[model samples]
Target chain A: MKKINRRQLLQGMVTGAGCVAAASMFGSAAFAADTRIRHFWWGNPSRDERTYKVIDLFKNANPGFDVAGETIGWGDYWTKMATQTAGKNMADLVQMDYRFLFEYVHRGALLPLDEYFGKTLHLEDFDKSAIAGGMVDGKLYALNIGSNSQVMIYNKRLFAEAGIEFDPIKWNQAEQMDIAKKLSASTPKGVHGIDDATMNPIVWEAWTQQRGKTFYADGKVQAVAADLESFWEYWKEMRESGAAPSADVSVANLGFKMTESGIVTGATAMSQFWSNQIVGVQSLMKDEIGAAMLAHKKGGMPGQFIKPSMFMALTRDTKNPELATKYMNAWVNDPAQTAILGLERGVPASSKVRAALEPNLTVSEKVSVDYFNAIQSSVGPLPPPPPKGAGEVNAAFIRMGTNVILGRISIKDGAAEFIDEASSIVERAS
Target chain B: MRKFFVRNLPGYAFLTPWLLGFFLLALGPMLISLYLSFTKWDMVGDPQWVGLAQYEYMFLKDKRFWQSLDVTFTYVILAVPARLAFALMIAIVLDKGIRKIGIYRALYYLPSILGASIAIAILWREIFNIDGVVNAVLINFGIQGPNWIGNPDTSLYTLVVLAMWQFGSPMLIFLAGLRNIPTELYEAAEIDAASKAKQFFSITLPLLAPVLFFNIILQTIEAFKTFSSAFIISNGDGSPADSLLFFTIYLFNEAFTYFRMGYASALAWTLLIIIGLFTAVSFYTSKYWVYYENERD
Candidate 1:
């Protein structure tokens, strides 16, 4: 056997390393050989199943065109999207949130759909307002997939136990308290009357809107500190009246996940909720749940507005714009594909799709659909897309609410802190 | 030059992969992040140079930046010394002639091995939650415990106690240091009628200074970079008024959640400076108390 010298060994090692790097490049090429246009969305398991079925339908109709779907939970979705966008490796199709739509579009992360409206995209069956939901700078960027509104969900069994004449449609804030007090007095010891989310974003946005105040405008939060103070006072009334649970109980269940939520566990009579979440909440409970608009002051302006639950967008990095747009159109407009999707995302944005699904709707879906249609008479216009740092502001709002409800800080100091943090976030982002 | 190149060619060739990785992966991104610290880039867009703006904002204007620093400093102060002290005490107790000590060492070191994991962080949350085991045990004693992880005043201490409990690494180091002491010295001190406490203060502590200093520097740096446990325990946003908002968590949120890459780069650089300063101070002060065994005067 011949012994290799040091120079020969070094040469061999370098050659080996080069071969490994070359192999990896070829490996990456092999990985990309499956030329499926990918669709990415943030959703739960049920929505994931619906999405995959619709993608299969699209693939079946258009043979030789394969599409892959990826789903992540809501919290980590944006983080993944940002990293992908930075690397210029975004999915072909992205599910867009309203708060992020304008930011993404302004940065040229999404392709504008205006150029393809008559060519490959069809939206004649959509309401003008529904079509306008994804409009940024007066041009279409994202296409609205579904519409939802702020809603309050209450246990029907508890309402019946109280035996009160309840009309959530016309009920003022005072009436809400009266119903809550009655519910609290009649309910058993452990079950509180309502969730301790008086100042939650789901409630705070509605409250701010009812006062005719925009939650955000021109990179600034429009509501003054006093507006937040009043929001605190309104909820403090409920807490002081023994209607909402204590701070520790509230903190323990900070989120609305099915596993530990107050409403699902029968620890609260009512929960601050969204129209899109009705089916989700009902899936966890055996007791019947009812849905309606949130509390409003006497003669206050309507704050509840229908919002696009999510939008479908062709990413700027998409390989084939025409084909991606066709897939998106089929996902929303094709009757069979839409039926397969059902109302898993939320209420359909297309009137034709809603008409097609009405016959096959389940009882709980019907209740949610009814709630969606009933609120339109009093529903406000769609809110403008939020500024860049609006997501941080959301966390700040929750933290401030926790501070107030938990009695860590006074409402005034909490408001000041929130405003300071919120303003700095927006200011720095722009 | 040719002769030098020829002589060192094999050594250089042997280090080729590491050198390539160092230059490409680590140093390249570091230099870019340093440049990014001077610009304004939201991940999707091209970075626009805005010299000194990010650093200026971080120092003078950013409230959360200061808050993160305050929280991290408090954690380092509370956790590092307490952990070292606890580890030393355990090491001293274990150094005595006890049977089956190897099993005890492994058992005590188990938490350090598995403690910095996401599963343990989740368990930490369960232990400090309102109805958690801590409160459950407190209830048996008829004493109602405040929500340790929920309240801002006490939330950080749960993280500190977690830091203290992972004292296994330093305890192992201390045990080795204890074993290295010459038994003859202790016997001589005993003949001189020196008390055990006196011998410990004079011999054990002074002899262990170098190891203790090494542990202090290592532990302090580790404490400053505490991320996953705090991030997971606080549910990623440092809730309950940002009390658990470690500097690394804030930097992560800035870079990823807000996509403020420019500012996050500045934050990362500041943290590097902080860790550098801490290590430098430890080294600078070591000459005063950390005595070597065979140093010539």
Candidate 2:
């Protein structure tokens, strides 16, 4: 048997502890070299697949770069992003939205990409307006992935069945409602004419813009109560006239996918969606679909504007921003990568990439391009980026609108409550 | 002190992991949250001291706060009693005289295991949708069913029914409690020519009171804290005019969705107080009904 004294035992324990401390320190340092930066974005499966392919191409292009990707559905994206933000573990490369980009930038979560525009990222080929949309307070914090405008997507078969042939750009709200009633009268028993868009903030934004005011300006709710009341009153009348689906149906399909929407499910003949959503809606249906501009306000201010489809940004705390920026460059600037992504993200922000991909574009994608070109000049100026706490305002709009359309509250009352609620929500953020 | 330390050394060593977790993960965050409840924290910036401002806003300025409280209280009040009563009824049925009761027990308990999941909530949404199974079934009987999860008036009841459907675990506990009741007492009642109803009123009610009390408290707290089903069903914004906004979902939205960490912390403490008050009330009232075998009520 071996005998051990206190000196020997103490010395052995100290050496072991020292060894563990050194191993842990060095182990983490080594782990950093092999760390695969995580990239997170929200998209449907098609976008997810294409993004993975682009990441693969990026890896091939830069052998030293390694990336792990996470894609969330649009509905769950913000929840995941916010939780990760709170935990200080946000993805290295984040796909941002115009509404959220300002909030993130204001929170110091996003790194300004302006300094790297020429050094690491190639912005020479990107559109001036596209680049402008990604700017916050004159500093570029994100890169526009694509450009998009809202479009009214109607089922062609439903339109033909209803004997309705209307030009999207020329149609006014009254004419649109008349067409909706015609379609509803001719459609199946359970079907309505138009999916309700009153709860959608985009519609309200357009409505507010038509009256020469924006929904939000200078971090405040800018629309007057009268404008809001008129917007709600019109929708309430539409619901009562059966030109749009009932409040119950709209509520049930709330936050649903294009595949599960009233238009695709044949419960409504027409629905309005972002231009990029056209392809996703097309994939789910055998029925032919047609695209048109949203009905303009009759003799009112311009109601349409081109906006960034989404933005690609770098998180401030990323370990490898250079590697991430290189990948972002490939995602938007590389012709080969851009072609694979196609119109899934909308028209490419890079004019060169757009021209290159236009010839090989699918028929549906061609429609989006033609629509974008047709409305490019007539559309209004882009509204200011949505303010912080804009999300709460959007929620309040949906809730109060539901109340009005469901006859639970008068339009005037709902409008008053909404202004009170929305203004406070915006003010609280500032 | 030395002798105590020596005697408890092995136990302390074994408890180290849990103790560390409790202090670092739970208690540490809890203390920070308590401090945060008195400040304004946006999660990305330094916290600002704004004593009682969050509470004042929640009570005086925020309509959704009061709305969520009403919704949660209504849910707990309705769901707990309905769930417990349903559980007790089934437990009595199973305990009285069933062969191969294990299969029946497992079948009944399945929903409890799966009920609170997001998948089940999605399934619930599908079943209650405008063109879903319930409405499809109703059509066959020449009756039009209102959209169950869409109409605000009816949406809450659907969630309540969901709560009642997961009564399996409470039922199992009641089963165990029923088994513990002595057969001799029933025999004695029978020998005295007591009626079945009379025996149940005299023996079963008093004996099973403790289990019922436990189930009531547990289920009430569970109902108050429900998030996934309400979240999934309402698509996380508690749409249809915020009818499905449970307290926890509202708190989550305030914290993660709105990034109002201090406000969320305040909401958390309010919920803690609400649950504590409810549990205390239940315990205080228990002496009126609950009876133990060895101790007097």
Candidate 3:
């Protein structure tokens, strides 16, 4: 055997190392190609299982792309996303909320979808209002996943027991109170007529909107005092009449999730929630829970609106912007995918998707869809974007409610404080 | 000098790791924070220079800042003395020959190690909840209990009690200080017909003054910076009308929840200055009370 020259030996070693590196890189790429796109949505196990089945169907239909599903609890979703975004590591696709979309978009952490769905994502086929909800400053930040409306859920058994023949659609404060009083009188031990929500800002906003007032005007709070005072008076009456739970019970109930909600758990006969949450509440109850238009005063403008429940946006930080847009488009537009998702995120915004899912829907899903449809013509205009420090404002609302419920403050005083605090928060944020 | 460097080169090399870490990790961040204190930042966009505007707003306009300061000072004033008294009493009790003294010592010391954690704070919330064990115990005695964690009037007091409960660390230090006092002094006092109380005031207290001083300073600082228990118990909202809103918790809210990083940084500097003033006052006052065993006057 003859010895090779030094140059030839060095060249041979280099070539061999390069070939090995290339082979490993090729192997990884091939492995990645075979793996499914990991999609995450915040939900409970039931929703997770359903989503997994949907992903399986997607993989089957689209052979080249496999999709993995992940679900987190709603509370942990934003926190996890914020941390992931800060670390410059995020899932391929995520369920996004309207509140957080601005945070992501402004931070350049989400991909805009102007080119993905036509030259600009066309609004002609979509409900213009719903499509507009997902746009920020004329740029499409997220694809509208679904639309939801607020509805009142009541126990039919409770209503029958109270002998209350109330039409929530046309009920005034006096009529609703009459029904509430009857229900309170007839409600058995360990149950109440209503699960009072003193902390719900949206409820106050809706009431005010019905009165032709808005929460904001000229970038300042416009309807805080009147809206808050009305809400406080309403809740105070309910509390005084034994229609709502005591302060302690109410606080504990506030901490409970949808499954453990007082209404669903039979502690109360009626509650207000987003239409999409109907199924989760119904699943926890033995009694049949039914939906109605949120109770309003007679001749009042219906303040209910079909707002985008949430959106799915591609992060700007994503290395594969085109891929992210394609994934979001698929999630939003694909009828097969929406059919499996159903009214889990309210009604799918895409008409085609909604139609596809409508035929095979469960009773609960149909109820939600019907609820939204009934109020479609009655809804007021979409609300403006909530100001920053909105969270602090909400907390302040809860605190004021606690004070009122505890009898530490009068309803009028609590209302005044809430308005003052909320306005201050808006001012600070501005 | 050249010979010394050659001989001590390995020793210097060994110290380099710690020296590098101190400058890079601790000192670097401290300087950065100082600079950040003067700027208005929200963690998203670039920081804006605001000079002393944040400080001015905090000192002049922010009612929450003053409220938090009052709460924190009240906590420090009550909690530090109460904690010291409890620790000193326990230390003296344990110093007496008792059965299973070591076991009692270890058992009492356990909470100090675990008390400051997030888990314990959550557990504290549960223990103080309306339907929790404390209420159950009260109810068993035919007594209805107030909502301890949910009541604004009693919420801060509950935290004060929690701080006082973790007296084991201070007690341990006091015990060591108690033991270090020369037995001869006590013995001489005993021969002189000195009462136990008298001996305590004359010998034990004087000798332990240094330790007591140290404990007061440390505990006051700890009480001032209390955040975890207040934050977790309040679910990070300073609930029931900001009753449990400690200074650091308020600072955290401004920094993270409200995204007022510049304001929070100014708050940080204010806290440092306050603590420095407190430490300075303690030192100045120590001359009148604290005794030094090693001093030659």
Candidate 4:
């Protein structure tokens, strides 16, 4: 090696780094003319593939229009979104969740879509209630792509093997519990009849709805100690009766991948799924998956309600606002686009699109649509979007719920702690 | 001053990149985080000054903070010593005359080379999964294995076992240290008819004290910073009643997951102090045990 001075080495290093950085900058600049608008959404592989296909369709129609699609598992989406928001690099189009919409809107992270409705977007065929769900302070900030409700999907093969009578409608929680106890007895060793719902907030929220109580109202916790105590007691019973799998089995099955879910892995016969996820859930397993309305109190109010499966929002940081709005319209209301997207997002929010696409839905897609429609009359109005600090409340719920399920804490104490923590978390954020 | 500058020009020039990097990246961010520890802010908005309230809450109220500390300490206490002992044992065995010693050393060091990778973390998760290899082996012995990764009682221990399995770097250090101990001493012990155990205690251990202490500090610090494997195995949020809630994982969650940047800053400072205290105490106590070959005094 030639003798090298320290100054010479430093100069070489600086030149090398400068060249690499300049190369990368030019590398992206080469494609800057493509008129790209990035879209970000969280979904399973099935929904993601359809989204990619739809993007391709749009690109083919509008020459030079480019979309870079980004997808993540549901758990990591908001973390990524929050980081992006802080950096002011949010994608042009965002698939938003109902719970986080209020926070994003309050922070002025999303654009109000009221201006885009008449020109770049036409949403006349969309449901009023679905649109209203995305409204905050009378300004439409997001457009619901589809409407979904909570549903219980069961393994029909497992039910058949156990010789249980299938009752898709008019069933009560008591009957479900009895079926849970009876079905587990007939299933194979270590396989439970019901998935563990102790840590799932949706199941608890549905129970609160069933009993004519709201879990959250006007950015304050409306759930009382009794609401949690009773809900936890039910799951505690579910676990003790061998109806639900043990915590270990449940945690293992709760892997980030959809394929590892309890129902898909044959760890449980019945599991909770959103009506929109029926097809995605079905795609993971070989068995025929069936879904029904969630069981409620025998004479209680309707527990399930139609809520936006997800919404497409235009980010405040978007460079191409008009193009983003046009894409949003295509995603939400365009019949041709819906033909490609189908019920993967949820049952279509637009009636015109739904009717046009119904005749062509796959077997699982039809099942989801039928289940969504069957509960139409009994379902409640769209729930108020979760208050700010809903994320903290949810994390606490899972942690405290895990404590109770694993016998680490008493039911009464766990419920009390959860309500207190959730209330405080909501209050603090406000 | 001109003469001084000219004489040191090359050295200063060589240091410019690292100096710039330190100021721009490491030291600058560290100072900002220290300031941020006194404020309450999500990353999206302007930071509001809370003035020690973040630290106050962490010290006085945060249950998860205590849980994370407890979990991390338990890991350090259990894993560091066990790892050191295993590495020392393996080093001693490998020090004996053996064919193809270089290959054996490389083979033994493979796990540590891959230890910090996400792939290994995922593989660890898979091996402890319900239908994974560990349970399969346990089944043959008519022993039903509890979910190692899921059960709170065993999850941290499984991570400790993983820590022990990757003792390659320390083992290599121990091998080098063992070589430095002259074979003449062992031969003298043999002439005295000292038992193998007696010779080890008298000759091997005391001679290896400095290296042992060095490995202890290295391994303990490494254990404190354990994040990736714990984060992966716990499925990110420290599930099954927060049993796998390592301190670093909790700090990450507070920062990113909950958007509690201010509290997270306080947590980062607290961890720094804790690791600093541990290192200081280790050095303080090392005087009693560590035997240096050269005595300055």
CAPRI verdict (incorrect, acceptable, medium, high) for model 4:
acceptable
- Restricting to chain A, the TM-score for each candidate equals 0.91, 0.89, 0.85, 0.88
Q: Give DockQ per model, in order.
A: 0.25, 0.25, 0.09, 0.29
lDDT of 2 by residue, B166-188 (tens): 99999998999899888999999
Best by DockQ: 4
Candidate 2 residue-wise lDDT, A1-430, digit = tens? 1222324433543332221101000001112443467788998778999999988887887777688888988767887787677667788889899888988898899998877778889999878888899888889998889889988888899899889989877688888889989988888887888888778777888888989998888777888889888887787767778878877778777675676788888889888899988887887788888888888888988888999988888997688787778788888888789888998988888878888987887778877888888888678999988888887888888888777767788878888889988888888987
Please compute the TM-score of chain B alone for each predicted structure, in the order given: 0.97, 0.96, 0.94, 0.98
TM-score each candidate.
Answer: 0.93, 0.93, 0.85, 0.92
- In candidate 3, which residue ranges exceed 4 Å CA deviation? A1-95, A103-109, A119-126, A168-170, A252-261, A264-266, A334-336, A339-342, A359-367, B1-13, B16-20
> Candidate 1 vs candidate 4: which has greater DockQ?
4
The per-residue C-alpha lDDT of model 1 at residue B249 equals: 92
TM-score of structure candidate 3:
0.85
- List per-prediction Cα lDDT, in the order shown: 0.82, 0.82, 0.74, 0.82
Cα lDDT for residue A371, candidate 4: 90
Give the Å error, residue A162, model 3.
Answer: 3.3
List where candidate 4 sits over 4 angstroms from the true fold.
Answer: A1-34, A188-190, A254-257
Between prediction 2 and prediction 4, the one with superior DockQ is 4
